[model samples]
Target: MTSAIDIAALDPASRDAGAVAHYGDPVREQRLLEEKVGLVDRSHRTVIAVPGADRLTWLHSLTTQHLEKLQPGQGTELLILSPHGHIEHHAMVTEDGTTTWLDLEPGSQLLGHLERMRFFSQVEPADVTADWALLSLVGPGTDEALAALGVDRLDPPDALDVPGAKFAQGTQPPRPSTIYRVAAFGAGWVRRVENGADLLVPRADKDTIDVEKVGLWAYEAHRVAAKRPRHGFETDHRTLPAEAGFTAPAVHLEKGCYRGQETVARVHHLGRPPRKLVLLHLDGITTDELPVPGTPVTANDRTVGFVGTAVRHHELGQVALALVKNNVKDDTQLRVGESTAQMDS
Candidate 1:
């Protein structure tokens, strides 16, 4: 789908206004968010389609979510891990009876892994990202804005039924759309508007709204505050899901078998993850001299772990998400660059 606005057109303004925040300068988009409830262009995310008689059974055997029980219109966060139990991709899995859809962040390599797995199974996998357009409506007044859009149902469809226009999910007629509720900042929600690429309509109702285009800066701050981890940053192929906080709702301990299950189960039962992801609030630090990703975290001259993401909070000062040794106490002082950081409660 063609974008209505070009990044180049807004580049100068974003730079001059210092609004190009978030990982990709989501400021212009954030502005639309503040003025009127904004529709975020999320077409960059990739979608993979799994279809066949064994679609549900096949995906159930692969992902971390309980795919076997998913009804239509229902979707849940899934983690695809490596054989060693390291995170490969974090996805939103939705089932529509005849088929299952895996929506993931771009560069997750989910399609490649799916294709590789097809050689061992009867499930048919295809890249369907081109067939859909995704959008996220965030900021304050999102619920009212959604209600104005004729979406009254607050609950998503069951995991196995075909997903359509509903609370978090909306699909243009004839084509299927699935929406997943993801963590966001103050009064924020993500909506995946699939199909109807031509019907690019922004929400028109405006009441009690303070929409601001959230740039990477704002998003980073919010994500850190929420203690939510990203794909490549807080997690990676070398990091176990348990270590990255995927053992909760994202990982299914009761689900039978899947890649990395043994390690995940072992860690869960032991209740001792090798590393822990912690929120760090650093004092005497500035954004211009923030610690780089993967910088080793040291406590008492002993290497503990590394930094994942760092951002200067508007109120909290310089903060970061660090992968640290599980043994570190909340008051433990860690050396990161020239600054010392303490784990925030």
Candidate 2:
């Protein structure tokens, strides 16, 4: 009953963005993920492998992050951009001497581009999506779960290290889980995505583990509450890293030339993005439904921005992330659907 074919027995009848949407009870599932050691089946996110002697240097020249200095097991993010400085592809990158592993949402044409760019380089890129499954654990129980699986020590500074002391929970551990706290999701923060960790496991060994399957509903609420940005939801081809406040983690400005470096550098030094990412606190005084994505945000009856994702958090009532023109200050009121929302600092 643990096979991919049998996971449907768990009633993973719901689907979102090509993945498991939920297991029937979204609220309870969310509770498990937030308050307990919960498991999420991330079969939706594609897993990519780039291996070779020149993998580090080759990837370094193509992405926004600095990879040449990456030690084995250090996980970071990479943003591939269009020449004029728009987000083209996004990948969660990590390396282990021989291979650079990546996890990403849809729109993963990165393998093709990586392979095409391998003219004389000794790099090899492969999409190992079918070979592995990403099983993520959410909540404070991550440490205990890892320890239960034989990993007693955690990485310092970067607690999110998956390789340093990373291990699994089944008969044999494979890619190891990266456990880290989500600092953005603080107690009083208007936006908090709650803390969680993800374990990358081999597809064959995946079904043997016992973990609660959380749905996208819970994930959406947590992510919106933390104000963390996602690829397709909060960004697109026209997005700049600075606009989403992701530059601090996703970009190494001091790194050498890469695609879209000019725009990133110029924006970091001189200009601000035309639009800025903001946290929207929906009008919770009423019983109206929360606003949904693609809804127009109006200020003083003037269209100014668009809503990204909104969620009714367990603690934060109704919250969402929006991209509004820089001129639209947080003090102003914005309209979403039939309800009015305010910007939260």
Candidate 3:
């Protein structure tokens, strides 16, 4: 799902340019992402478009969210699960009257699953990543930045019957991009996540917009601090939404049947997930290199879990997200590789 355009190259100060690791000043960038504003390149993500009259209802029946009443410009997240309740796919969804748009991490197989379940439905899911590039603006300066781009404010109107509203074609009045607390994108779509706004712009027009750029390190540090779990980083093949605090925003417990509703309901009413996610504060003095994901997390010399996303925060020196045995005591001392780790309070 990566774009041909190297978005990291957009930052003149970027180090580890291939992965957009940092802009030579990770702490400053992290501060910008937290207090001011920082733009992040996410063109490596994927986009999917599902068009047809039955798009919303079709998605509602197949995923973990209640999307049948979804309005145009409104945004929500959904998870596709295995019949046994394991999370298989996750996407941020929004409808634009004529089509349902899905924003997913790279390598998501949600599109193929949607197509296979189209037994006579009017929906047709197609990969549209080639036509779009994703970018994000984080921190308190988002509104000001959007205003500078001629997007006065984010107030998406109700879904109208415009045929090409998404891309603004055929003389249709330019439709506002989807907004959930934030709005962006002039020729594509936008969605807000926590304290940031993600903009998807046409590939040809992406470079036209001007903004201060940051690297992936800044974003990851903030995400780890916020306790937000990501798809690939926080999940494994046997992951359940409840294990990562994904049940509230990503699942609708009482709506209707989905691929994995049975397992979700059983876990909710009968028992707790075997593992639970926690934030860990690492003892930086114990190691020079930060622990990477998949590093074994041990309690009393016994492996208890594995690390997910680990980062050096601008404020909290070193932090990480990990999945540990639910039975582990809250006060237990833990170790991440050679460093002493404590549950972040």
How do the predictions measure up, each by TM-score?
0.72, 0.81, 0.85
Clashing pairs in 3: none
- Positional deviation of residue 302's Cα in model 2 after best superposition, in angstroms: 2.1
Report the lDDT tens digits of candidate 2 across residue range 1-345. Answer: 122223344334422345555666667767776777776777667888888898888888898877776766456677888898888787776565567778888546778877878999997788988887766667777667656655443443242221111222242222112212221111100101135555667777765556666766677776777778877667756889878766655676656799899998777665567888888888876656766566888998998888887777777778889888888887897888777888874
Candidate 2 to truth, TM = 0.81
Q: How far is candidate 1 from the true structure (C-alpha RMSD, Å)?
A: 9.8
Q: Residue pairs in steric clash, candidate 2? A: 191-225, 192-225, 192-226, 193-226
Best-to-worst lDDT order: 3, 2, 1
Off-target runs (Cα >4 Å) in candidate 1 are 1-39, 120-122, 156-212, 284-287
Q: Top model by lDDT, which number?
A: 3
Our tally of clashes for model 1 stands at: 25
Q: Write the per-residue lDDT of candidate 1 for residues 1-345, one digit (tens) a residue.
A: 222344335554322122233434444443444444544444455767788877776777787766665666445677888898888888766555566767676545788777877755668888766665344555455556656655453433212232221213222121112234322222222333221110112223112333333344554565576687877778745898878766554665556789989887777667778888899887764435778678888898898888888876666778899888788898887888778888974
Poorest stretch of ten by lDDT in candidate 1: 193-202
* Error in Å for residue 247 of model 2: 0.7
| Residue-wise C-alpha lDDT for candidate 3, range 48-157, written one tens digit per residue | 98999989888888988778877776777888999999988888776667778898887567777878899999988999988977788888887787778777566432
lDDT of 1: 0.60
